[model samples]
Target: MSWYQHWISFAKRLVHVVAKPMKQNSGQGGVMVHPYRGYGSSREVFVMGRVFRQAALGRAIPRRGVLRDTADVARRIFRRGLADARVDIRIGNNQLCITTDRDGYFDAQLPVSSALPVDVSWHRADIMVHAKGYPPVRTNVEIYVPPPEADLLVISDIDDTVMFTGVAEKLKMLYRLFVRKPHRRTAFPGVASLYQALYRGKSEKAERPILYVSRGPWAIYEMLETFFQLNRIPVGPILFLREWGISWRKPWPRRAEAHKRDLIDRMLALYSDMPCILIGDSGQHDPEVYTEVVKAYPGRIKAIYIRRVDQDPKREQAIQRLRDELAHTDCELVLAADSVLIAEHAYAQGDISARGLQAVQRDVDEQQNDPA
Candidate 1:
C-alpha cells in the first residue's frame, strides 16, 4: 500500500483502540440535555439541543491549562449521544414534543399562535429530556427574535474570517482549534468591532440579527461562544454548526459548503423581509458558496465581504471574477485585506454609523500596536 494509505490505516486502528474505551464508559451515570441558543420570528420559533449520557456534566471547555482543555476536547469529540430520546419544549403557553435523531440531536420548528413580545430581542424556552431508563432532565434555552425595527441581518463565518485559524493549512488549523484554550484562540484584528458595527447597523437601536456560521463541529460550540465573549463581540442568537462524525471509514468530516449554504438559506427564509450581509474568508470555498447564494436569493443579499487571508494571486483573481460577475446585481462582493477596509465600505454604503466605523478603526489600531 502507498504511504498515505498505510498511515490512514494505522490511524484508524489507533482511533479504534483509544476511542473504544471512552465510548464504552460514556453515559453510565445519567442522561442530560444540552441546549443551544435558538432563533425565531414573530410567528414561529426554532429550537435545538442534544441529549448525551454522561456520568457528570462538566464544562465543555475548562477554565485553564492546555492539558485540561485538550482532554475536554476529546471528551466532547467522543460524547455518547443518546439516540431516540424524547424532548419536550415549551415557549410561553405553547408546548411541543419531539424526539432526538440517531445523533441525539432534537431540532423543532413550532408555530407561535401569539406574537412574541417586541420589547426584548431574546425569549426563553424550557426543554425537558426524557429517556427510557433515566429521569427527566430539564433546561432553558434562549431564543433570539429580531425586533420589528431591524433592517439588516449579518451572517459571518467563524474560521479564518473571524479568528486566526489557518483553515487552508489543515494541520495547523486542527492544532489551534483543538489544543488551544478558549482564551488563547485569537480573533482577527478588529473583527469584534466590525461585527458589532454590522450588528448595530445604521441605527444605534437597530438590534439587528447577527448569525454566526461555522464549518467546525458542534463539540466546539462552547469554546467558540466563550471566545466571542472574551473578544467582546456581540453574541449571535444562535450558532449554526455541523455535526461531524468520525469513524474508521470516515476519518475526516465532509465538506462544509452544503452545510453553510443550507444555513444561509434557512436564515434567509426565517427573516424574509431582512436583507443580509455575508462575511467570510477567501481561503476556502466561501466566495463560491456566497456567490451561489446571491444568485439563488437574487436581491436578498446587500453585500458580501470576503477576508483576504493569503497573498495567492490565483485565488484573488478567482474572487475578482466573482466580484465582476456580481457587478450587474444589486449586491457587491468585496475582497478586503482587513476589517478597516470593510468598515470603510460599510460606512460609505450607509450600513453602519460613523461612530461604528471609528470604533472599528480604533480596534484595528489597538490590535496592531499591541506588543503582545
Candidate 2:
C-alpha cells in the first residue's frame, strides 16, 4: 500500500490495457476489413472497423419482412488501416438514410421503390458503419438503375453462365442454388465484365440494354449482389422465380410456371418497341423460352447467343433446334464457350470501337480462359 508500490501497479495495468485487442469500423457499410496484426500484442498499435444493417427507430423488425436471428453479427479484425482498407460494398437501389444507437451499430430503413409486378424482384440497402472509434460514416447512396431503352435487349441466365451452379449436373446446381451461402457461389468467367459492357450503353442511344433473366429464385438477391460487388461486376435488373409455393415441388426439374412465363410476357412488353439481343445459356428453360420469344417476335430479336453447358446429344439437338430456328428469323445464333466473345461482338455493334471495349473484354476473356 506504499505510494511507490501503487505507482508500480498503475504502470503495469497501463501496459496490459494497451496490449488488449481492439476492433473499429470502416466507413463502408455491410463490410469489415481488419489490418494484419504483428507480433506486438499492443492493442493501441492496431484499430478495427465494422459495418451494420439496422432498422428504423422503434422498428426492431427488419423492413425486409424477414426476421434476422440477431441484430448484430460480430466479426474480429486484427490490424487497422491499409490499402483497400475499407470493405467494398454496394448501395442497392433501395437504401436510404441511417441512424445509430449508443453501441455505434448502423440501422436504416430500406426503401420500397417500384410497384411494377413481375416475378422480377429488386432489393435496396444502405451503408452504415458500426465501430469503436470515429463517427458513423454513411456512404453515398447509389440505387440500381435498370437498363435504358436500347435497339437491342440482353436477357441472360445465372448458373453455368454467370455463376458455376453445376448446371451440367442439374440436381447439384439446384441444391447449391437453394442451400449454399452467398459466399459459397462461384461467378463464371468474364460474366461481370460482359454484363457491364452490355449495360454501360454506347452513346446512350446505341447502347444495348441488358437484363438478367435467370432461373434462380429471389431468396438470394443479397448474395447475388455480393458476388457482383466483390468481383467488380456489372449490375442489372434481375428476374427470378418465387420458390415459396408449389413451384418448389414441380417435377421435370423446372416447369415453365405461370409466374415465370408471365414475367417473360412482361419483359416482352417492356421491349415491345425495340429490337433486342437475347444472351442466354442452354442449361435450363432458356433455350425453349428464348426460342419461343424469337419466334413470336421474328425480326425484333437481333441475335441469339446460347452458352452450351450440357454435352448430351438429345439436349444439344434441342438447343440446336432453337439455333436453327434463329436462322429463320434472320437472327444470327452463335454458340461460344463463355459470354465474353458474344459480349465483345455486342459491344462492337453498339458503335463502341473494338479498342474502346478491349480493356473490359480482355479482363473477361482472361477470366474465362484462366485455368483456375
Candidate 3:
C-alpha cells in the first residue's frame, strides 16, 4: 500500500481501539428504535429504521467542549446494532412486520390499503421494536407522500453543496465533522432559502418532494438531522446515507459514486412520473456520477446544478466538458459559484416563484454581509 493508505489504515485501527472501551462502558438499558422518515406514492411506501440497545441514563453528551464532543461522536460511531430484532410498523389499518439484518437495519416497502388523505402531505407510521428480553420500544416515523398537484422533484447532495464541509480538504472536513460543536457547523449562504424555494416551487404551494442523498455514514444521521433543523433547510423525506464498514482488509468506506447513483436511481424509480433536478458539488465525483445518471435516464432530468467548491483548472475543465456534452440533451448541467445563481436559474426556468428568488437573494446578501 502507498504511504497515505497505510497511514489511513493505522488511524482507523487506532480509532477502533480507543473507542472499544466506550462501547464496553455503555450501560445495560432497554431496546431502542430509530425510525427514519419514509417516502411513498399513493399505492405504496418505503420505511426504514435501525435497532439498538439504548445506553444508560446520564450518558448524554454535554453541549460544550471539544473532548466531550469527540467522545460523543465516537460513542455514536461504536454503538452496537441489535441484529435479528423484529420491527412492527402500523399505518392506519395496515400493519407490517420485518426483521433487522446483521446491521440492525430494516427496510421494507409496503402497499397502502387505505387511501391517504389528500389534505395532508405527511403521514405517520407507528413503529415498535421487539427484542428478546427488553420491553417493546415504540416510536413513530413521518412519511412524505407528494400531492398530485406537485409539478417537479428535487434530489440533492448534502456535503459541500448545501453545507460547508470542505470535502476537498480532508483534515478540515474531519475537524469540522468530528471535533466542532454541532451548532458551529454552518451551511452555505442562502442554501436553506434556495431549498425552501425549490420545495415551494412555482405555485408557492406546490410542496414538491425534495430528497437528500449523502455519502456519509448512517452513524451521523442524528447529527445531520439536527443540522438541517437548525439551519432551517427544507427537510426531505429521507437522507440516504451509506453504512461505512471499516475492516483490516478495507480500511475505508465504499466508493461514493456507486452509493449516490444507487440512491438516485431508487428515488427516480419510486417517483417514476416526476421530472427531477439534481444538485451536487464539484468537490468529488458528482459531475461524473450525475453525467452517467443523465445518460441512464434520458429526458427525465430537467437540470443539474453543481456547486463549484474546487478551484482547480482541470476539475473546472472536466465539469465544463460534461456540460458541453449535455448541451444537445434536455438536461442542462450548470456549474455555479453559489446557491443564489442556482435559485436565479430555477426562477428563469419557471421552477420556483419570484418571491422565492428574492428570498434567496436577500439571504445571500445577509450572509455575505455578516458571515460569522
Candidate 4:
C-alpha cells in the first residue's frame, strides 16, 4: 500500500482506540465471581460475586503515591458496593441462578445430588456465568472437606482475634480498616503459629479445617484473603457479612451478631460428626454465641478460646460464666490475653505436637521482645 493509504489506516485505528473509553464507560457491564469456599459434607455449594457496569473495570482508588495507596484502596472499596444485578452460574453439571439483593452481591446455596470431588484440602470447581448481552466469564470456586481422621474443626473471628482492628473503638476501627493495606495490617502476636499448630494437630500433615467468621462485609473479601495470604495464616471459607460500602444514608449499619450466630449453627450442623475448636474474642457476642453453640450441640465443641481484647473485667467474668455453664459437657473454655496459653491447652488436649507447642510459645516470646 502507498504511504498515504497506510497513514489513513493508522489514523482509523487510533480513532477506534481513543473512542473505546466512551463505549466502555457508557454503562456496559458484566458478571464477576469471587472465590467461593465451603465445606463438603454439607453437600452445599455457595457462589458469590457482583455484576458491575460503567466502572467495574476501573478501580477508583485515589492513588496519588505510596503515601496515599492504603487510603486510596479504601476509597476504591467504599465506591464499589451496592450494585444489584442478575447472574446465572453452572457448577459442574448443575446450573444454579439467582438475582443479587439490593447489595449487588449474589450468594447462591445449592445442595448437590453428587458431591464435587474434594480429595484435596480444597476442591477447585470452574464455574461459568451467563449474563445476557455480555460475553461469558469463568471463575473458580473451592469446596473444602474436613480431612478424614481429622480431630477438630477451627472456626475463628477475624477482626480482633486474628488481627488487631480496634473493633471496640468504632472511629479508630474505621481508620484502621480504611488506612491499612492488607500487606501492612498487623496479625496478632503468635496467632498464625498457634492456628498452624491447631491445624496441624498431632500430625504435621494434618489439614484440620479452619473456617473464618467475620462481621465485616463481602466487599472486603479480597482484602481479608490477601491479609491471610500475606501473614501465612491457614484459611478456610469465610462466612457472614453485610455488604461493605460506606453509606451516609444509613449512618449506623445493622449488627451482624445474629448473622454470625447463624453461620456457627450451620457449621455445627454440617460438621456434626466432628468436634470443633471455636476461636473468637470478647469484643462482641462471641462468648454468648459460642455458649449457645455448646448447649445446642453437646459434646460437639472441644474447646472455646476467647481472646481477651477488650480487657474489661465484666466481659472476662461473663465469659467465665459461659465456661462454668459448659462444665457439664466435655468442652473446655479458655479466656486469656495470649495465644501462648491456648497453645498449651491445645498441647495438653493433644490437638498439637510438642514441637508445635514450642513453636507457638517461641513465636509469642519473639513478638513480645520485638522492639517494634
TM-score of candidate 2 against the unseen true structure: 0.53
Better of 1 and 4 by TM-score: 1
Q: RMSD of candidate 3 to the true fold?
A: 6.9
- Model 4 lowest lDDT segment of ten: 19-28
Model 4 lDDT, residue 240, Cα: 48
Q: Mind giving the per-residue lDDT tens digits that candidate 4 earns over 1-372?
A: 676775555444333322332232222234444444545553666666654432333344332333233333333444433344456655556567677666556777766776455565565556555555667656666766666767688888887898887655544433333344432336777888888888888988778878887777665565566567766788765554566445797776566677778777877777777889889888888888888888888888888998888667887788888888999899888987898888899899988999988988888888788764
Question: Model 3, range 1-372, lDDT digits (tens) per residue?
Answer: 676775565455334434333343343445667788999988889899888765542456543344443564455555678999999898877778999998788997888898888888899999988989888877899999999888898999998897777646645544443444433446788988899999999999999999998888876676677668877898888998888878798799999898999888988998899999999999888999899999999999999999998789999999999999898899999899988899999999999999999999998888788744
lDDT (Cα) of model 4: 0.67
lDDT (tens digit, per residue) of candidate 1 on 127-181: 8889998888778989999999999989999888988877456544433434343
Worst 10 residues of 3 by lDDT: 16-25
User: Each candidate's root-mean-square deviation in Å?
Assistant: 7.4, 17.1, 6.9, 10.4
Q: What is the lDDT, from 0 to 100, of the residue 36 in candidate 1? A: 88
Q: Which stretches of candidate 1 lie over 4 Å from their true place?
A: 1-28, 56-78, 168-185, 248-252
**Which of the two candidates, 1 or 4, achieves a greater lDDT against the reference?**
1
TM-score of each prediction: 0.84, 0.53, 0.84, 0.77
Ranking by TM-score: 1, 3, 4, 2
